[model samples]
Target: MTHQTADATDHPTVAALVARSNRLGGDPRNTNYAGGNTSAKGTAPDPVTGQDIELLWVKGSGGDLGTLQPKGLAVLRLDRMRALADVYPGLDREDEMVAAFDYCLHGKGGAAPSIDTAMHGLVDAPHVDHLHPDSGIALATAADGEALTREIFGDQVVWVPWRRPGFQLGLDIAAIKAKNPQAIGCILGGHGITAWGDTSEECEERSLDIIRRAEDFIVSRAASRDAHPFGPQRPGYEPLPDDERRARAAALAPVIRGLASFDAPQVGHFTDSSVVLDFLARERLLPLAELGTSCPDHFLRTKVKPLVVDVPTSATVEETVTALRAAHAAYRADYAAYYERGAAAARARGEEPPAMRGADPTIVLVPGVGMFSYGRNKQTARVAGEFYVNAINVMRGAETISTYAPIAEDEKFRIEYWALEEAKLQRMPAPKPLAMRVALVTGAASGIGKAIATRLAAEGACVVVADLDLAKATAAAAELGSADVAIGIAMDVSSEAAVQAGLREAVLAFGGVDLVVNNAGLSLSRSLFETTEADWDLQHNVMAKGSFLVSREAARVLVDQGLGGDIVYISSKNSVFAGPNNIAYSATKADQAHQVRLLAAELGEHGIRVNGVNPDGVVRGSGIFASGWGANRAAVYGVPEEKLGEFYAQRTLLKREVLPENVAAAVFALCSSDFSHTTGLHVPVDAGVAAAFLR
Candidate 1:
């Protein structure tokens, strides 16, 4: 995607962009496996002349900045950016959230803005360039990282303690910009640095200088260390003679390919790191809480901590590696579960999914294991190891100091997935109809609403449960509670006026809304064919009209917020599969499903995701299969209702009936990331009963 022709000269401005990125560096090594991207402000079209504003040449996605080109840059209207930022707070969740990816936001059309785009936005410089510089990251992740920032940039740089990178961080910057006009650059605590100047060269100069200084600090600090910072492995730290440290590196070199490359008589391979380890081996070292190493970006080389994976050298190399692989899988799965739970909690609260990865899978802390800085290449891996080695040392050293608290779960998400993360890897999928955004569920009191709400919640959506039956919604909410779990509100999901009031209150609680599960239908009507119109009207008003009214109000909030949301109708399977009873129920179910498709097409353009879940002949549940379903089965199978489930349990090919909980889990699956790409699709949750594959 090379965009600009080389003028056969070094663009000083581009050089400065590159230089600025290197300033906070330990190593200006090309850290991102994908390289770097620099964006100069593009020219806007003269409205009357109809001329296009020229965009700065930035490296396109997958194009690293180590060797950059103009095609990598996305040409965009610098002026329209604020509006774009305000409109799309959760844009960071996109697989690729670059201004260049879509023509609509940040002028990125198919090309994304840098992963650090938002941080760059904070500077307000005409040009912004981001790179994975070793020195800057190392300095940022250090124990006394803030003091380092003060030592180098002084008052000129706005120092932000390590926080998750995301919309809120962007919002914070926007707020900070208002207060301090002179501040141009900022250091993200536990992250990296941002430098900006009126001219790209000036900014570049400042950034490069900063990196060199930070790198020097790293070198000197390593010299001051008495022992290996990570402490001694296998416990009971023994004082290692200096010569023994070099001997150890020598002995370990063959196993780890890269350490030997940097080995030298004057500066032995990993000597400084060795010193830090010896220190760590000491019994009284840095407390575990003080340790902070999450990324190669946060600290040039060590993305994760130096994991002292307790594997035996005695084991075959392949066997050891296999164990490591298994451990890694378990760690990832556990982390993913954590992510799903937290994300689901937020979804229940009726908000957009957190911008940062819920799991923070990026940084894994194995208590006694070596570290991992997942880079595109080995150089990146080795460089990251350098800082991780030191930081663990500092953390151990800091045991004398007060405990260091890492950023909170809410805060971590702010940075890792911040809207401005430098564009690097794959572009986020074009905004799916639903996306894995968050949605709130109301009328999640029990039965259908609970099932639908639970389903959506499980889909990794952050959901909220609101119902007149607060006890029930609360219980439901209890099931979903995690780090950032969903909230339970007491009220009706209906009542045009109540809906308005509840939504207003709920929206104020969370930032906004995305999806509304209109599951608050009530039924006192016994039978339509056997009963009167008054009975029917009551059912229609509460069940049918209530959903319509709620949908209208919910849509207003969704559309007004400008974040397209989803609306799932918990229509029953009776809509299509009729039974002798439930005449009124069947009519409402049919209407609910029919309404879903219409709503989907209408809101499609608004970026809203809407769908329906229809479950038929669902048996209520106390346990896996205890009571409510038995009577239904007993009657259907012509046996005593108690023996009914026994008859039907083997009826399906899978030998199961759709438990109410099964329906609930199904609903969640459909709305979560598993089914994010699917909308306007009616998902049936009747367990094979609908298919009749079983004899």
Candidate 2:
């Protein structure tokens, strides 16, 4: 490829690079999410020298190419970056070179330069791209990849043997390019592919061309083969019907999540996509999954391998769950040994290995159900699943054309425990207090429930806003965050069937339940003589009975997860204080208050904590009060409806009005680490109402 002169305007060159990157990344067939980098070189005026200087702009660390912005690009002086080659230490010290990139930065350098910055800067091309497209990786990981590369594109594409990515790999690619000027790109052994061109358009085209050709080669060869790449589908391993699979997944998600969170709590993602189902049903699933994923991007998120449960689709949920526990224990033991072997290998080479990561597997596959991937948050978990699917595609293609041969186990261990990778993990911001936890708040569409949901989402928990009105709940969920962070579902707590269905939706959305807020209620202000049996029943059903049902249903999931969880009841101060013309409301609240204590006592053995928040007279922005409760209470107390809030506030010791936000804050506190050890306790958000104080 001939070198093109630097563009006169640097902006257009970078703009074109970003455009090309987005095109490649937006398509899943081009590359897995955030698994590729693109670069462009141009001429820019130096701030200090007032002269034209060559600069390299590349996608920075921790950014997805599909959503790359100008600010996400790291700009470096190409001359300064190339100069590092003179003092570059041997491959053993390649990590030190990453730190040296900072010194070569131009201006603010935008985002942090990634390790692949060297590959972009030293490639000696105006435009460069390195991608992990499934088709390209299929050929790269094939046993005869070098021969296939020669056969696929003849001499147009070259083959680079397996080498760990760093400064040395960059130098090696540059040398390959210099030696074969006529070569368009190279298939990186046990990795992906690299392509370059004199211009951005040409580079992108070459990349797509390589990917298309590799895909065609595999497809054509597969057509000639007699057997399926993954072998025949096992007799009892076929996927269940869509509805059955989802229901089974809902039941097992908590158990798998609990086991995966042995080291730390994790959010989970469940997928029954075609790729996952096809792979799971195949007879070769166990052996191929055990061999682990080939791509570095794949294993880093999915872990070295997945845990494949052997239970058949016809097995009962209870029996399947029992098998899962035994399998999980064995998986942990094997991972421990794998870590020791890798550490020993490092020691033998006179290198101190980084501490092993969590021993629990991030991915779980069941033949009848689907794939479940876990991570510290919902987005991470979902992305991990997507990467595993990409790995599946790679395996399917590789096995079709030739034997799927990944890098050595020691190499996988080396990359998995790299010091640089550990540094990236350490640099991540501290997680929010509610991070990795999932909360389902009943009646979260408005008032106290909505406030609580908002606060929980802000603190980093995935929230499910459950209300009788699906539209309102959906609107509230939208306000909170994206689907990954929050979702909405309809629930009529008065019905046990509805309660169970709502909980199932919550689990499907975010793995399992960690926090349950029983806040759904209706208030009827009436004296004992005026209260009808119907009114009493309605109040009790929505408040007392409803709380019990929600707790009972959620408790099953919590216990199954085996991770300690919190259950909060939104009881009222009226539960302790006797208020006139409020017989039914007060009695229901009192029932809720006692139920909290009883549940706390019963569930403590399972590490589930039940607590309550007693809020007095939340008139403003309150659904219960706005639905005629405020006017009814006002008439009973000989006060105007507008003055009801003031009347309630004046009676309190502090004389301050209690708002919905105050109640939400109390709920947050009860569910926070500060109250981890304090169960069966109710904190009053009643502005110091002495009458409601706990005896």
Tens-place lDDT per residue, model 2, 281-369, is: 99999999999998889999999999999988999999999999999999999999999999999899888988877889899999979
lDDT of 1 at 128: 47
Against the true structure, whose TM-score is highest? Answer: 2
User: The CA-based lDDT of model 2 is what?
Assistant: 0.92
For every model in order, what is the number of clashing pairs?
Answer: 113, 0
Q: List TM-score per model, in order.
A: 0.42, 0.97
In model 1, state the lDDT of residue 458: 54
TM-score of 1: 0.42
Tens digits of lDDT, candidate 1, 408-451: 54444333333344233233444332323345665676665666
